[model samples]
Target: MSATTTYNGNDTFHGWAASAKGAPLVLQEMTLKQWTEDDVEIKISHCGMCGSDDHYLCESWGPSTYPCVVGHEIVGTVTRVGKNVKYVKVGDRAGVGAQSGACQRCENCLTGNPNTCSDLKGFILTYGSRWPCGTPSYGGYADKWRGDQHFVFKVPDNMTNEIAATFFCAGITTYAPLKRTDVKAHSVVGVMGIGGLGHYGVLWAKAMGAKVIGMSHSDKKRDVALELGCDDYIVTSDKEDRKRYFKKMTHILCTGTSPDFQWEPYFDLLKVNGHFINVSLPKWDFPPFHTYDILKNQVFIHGSAIGSPNEIREMLKFAAEKNVRPWIQKYSMKDVNKAMENFRAGKPRFRFVLEN
Candidate 1:
């Protein structure tokens, strides 16, 4: 039986949202908008609360438009599909990530880098952004969503909706950088955080056959990190222990959002010609580093966002093949507010998925 055939929107759906600035999320009734020829209406079954969602809703990053539906990690079955959509058909299990739409004709779009498109003015975010038609783009906090089919991905049959939802964003964010750095077998990898993204890094890197090391400030996540496939766990809070592990890593992926991190210690962790990649967006000035830090070791520092469609596809296939399932906590879509609060409190075991 096709997955989509099971969806029946008979009951009124409740979605939780922050109605305004500095206010708690309110549960409200939402109606799915009319669909377009290139649109696929998904009856949302699960949504993951992301850090970006928290940033936007709390206006920590910027002022979020009121009534914003803040969620990006979405998974559901296609309730309807437009005639133009061949990649996804009605009744297909699918998902949408951080990006909802981008101009398909821009050079970046044509080159498979739509995420970095310069002239792509109408890039519709999954939430907190207006669509080209001026309708506010509600997210997976709702019962159903109508989105352009190009941005939707067919969930692998082997993956559960709860797991597939988190992969839409958090999985791709870490996977993109790993692939860009050519992480491979025998690579000595260091992941610098134990939160949502970092956990995925440990799983993905190990799956890629890397000798993975999980780096964190404390030993609290040590057991979990090792269980997630890290070859070792490094507690950076102990300066002596950190120094002991210095110069032993080939690539260090910094997933921590803490702004007060001591860069020199991490720089010392790199092997010659190693790369330090940052995926977390933290508010802080880049600290001064002696030229010798780079000159002596030939190290490079860079940043990466979510992956392109092709990259996401590759990561998803890799995940399925390796059984790199994320550790996630599931909640009902109606409990979006509570879920977001728990996420803010860092209360999830790792990641949180809201079921519809």
Candidate 2:
């Protein structure tokens, strides 16, 4: 038999899958992509739930490929590793994030930004994606996960799987932008939203020695933000509150996906030539704004995705050293629906993780 058949014959994995758009995930059996020498198979122990999973499930981002298993922030035990896989061995604790594959030859990939690879074949998401060979890729909302070893990361022994799982997606997404903006002790950083991604932005910015200001629509997350180490909290809608911190921040990390996000007011909060990086993926298109906001102050606006493999490693080590941990609520893998319901109801203190 050929290699494809040989590999396909060895295993059929099981996971919770959505059969159609807006459908609830149901237990199902599925097959992984044809294994290659560069592949690794993991028996999942924990998986973090991200906002992106809900977007894909509800077709909020767009139409998703169905029969989709959608958890990406994965932490697990390495059950098997292909001959070519190194660093990750059987029984080792490892994790995979939002990215699964990328075209290594691309300039972005070679330069350590595989998450933003330019080629069509690159930018493979952990789920809601297909392998180049036309096989559908499943994610970590299951008993096992298989993917390119290059995208798999070894978890730090000092961290628990539940905590490590959140780092894969939420941690990297926030950490990448903070590092890129060169946030330091002198920098005053504004972290908007105070939810899943925003909480991390607040934690890491403070950990990086920057003074963090937690900005939200109201006082709901004020206590939590302060608990997460925010130097101060701002209610974005309050004009008096806005005036106190106007033009004070050196960098602002916008992590909220609200369709009604006030654009111009946030620009007003930035210092001249300051950077404002947005990491949220909202289903709605951002409202238009005036060009004067950019020309008048030379403000820089950017959009960042998840981090590279090297960045992931760096983030993990930093998180361990700093003792940074996410506030999370856990659910059994079998109760994914109930977990998702709580998520939709906005009940998570910050993030949620599923234990397999």
Candidate 3:
């Protein structure tokens, strides 16, 4: 590999960045990273804001690097590409998700699970971290973003920028888990929390030929759930209603976490050899479920991260063909700080996309 070249000694791009944790994100100028042989630079047209942005901005997850630009659901046209970037080229439509790079030769990566790559020493997140070259990694809350070829996904032409952007994070997050379970026509899949990930969960489940049941706490999402192709909708707000589905679902894809939620009922809804997959990071940890239920029912509780490069490709193709779209509220990049506040309060109907 050859040495990477700096964009220009003094070249900088404009974006919204947090100067300190919990501080209002302000418009600021940031330096462009040096170009590596395997990197792709994008002039971002759309960026999907995520709760992870709020988590880091509020320091909920942990301490974050200051002057951080945080929005990972990114989509744009490729403006430049490194010499060895085989897939993406200059002027191509592209997108990137939660990750930017990973050690491609590792055991986990070799098996096509780079999202959960075991190469901890070389794993790189899209933002709130440093690149392999020690550059402070800023995410898609910017005019432009540069990522490695490995993590950048080529957006399908049929998909719009905003929809393709969510596929980078929210879409793939749900899609990966379902695909891993190999959902098919006869599968009975329940999508819990019909919001950001849940919406995608329902669409992906239905598109994958599963009989999808959208389960939310209220009736607010009933129409949206049905619009997204859910075969049935269940309001889990009533405890008695949950019992109606006792041992009904073969798999439950949990996309939202509620502190006051009763777990036993959802557990009871699972079949003898059921699977409960959780992708949401709720503030409160769930209390223990019935020990006997787990032992006797053989339930599998699975945690999924984002998808690998191969999986991303498969999902993009699937989404484009099936027109898998996210219900999004579009906001301009200038309104990001205000948008962040609302995002914390759950203002967006499903997902929020920032147009640059």
The candidate that achieves the highest lDDT relative to the unseen native structure: 2
Model 3 Cα RMSD, 1 decimal: 2.1
> lDDT tens string, model 2, 133-169?
7888889999999889999999999988988999999
lDDT of 3 by residue, 34-122 (tens): 67788788999999988777877888776889889999999999987877999988898899999987888888888888888777756
What's the distance in Å from true for residue 354, model 1?
0.8
| TM-score of each prediction | 0.92, 0.96, 0.93
- Any residue pairs clashing in model 2, and if so which? none
Of 1 and 2, the candidate ranking higher by lDDT = 2
lDDT per model vs. reference: 0.81, 0.89, 0.85
Tell me which residue pairs clash in candidate 1: none
Worst 10 residues of 2 by lDDT: 1-10
Q: Runs in model 2 with CA error above 4 Å?
A: 1-9
The C-alpha stretches of model 1 lying farther than 4 A from their native spots are 1-14, 31-34, 283-292
Candidate 1's TM-score reads 0.92
The per-prediction tally of clashing pairs is 0, 0, 0
Candidates in descending lDDT order: 2, 3, 1
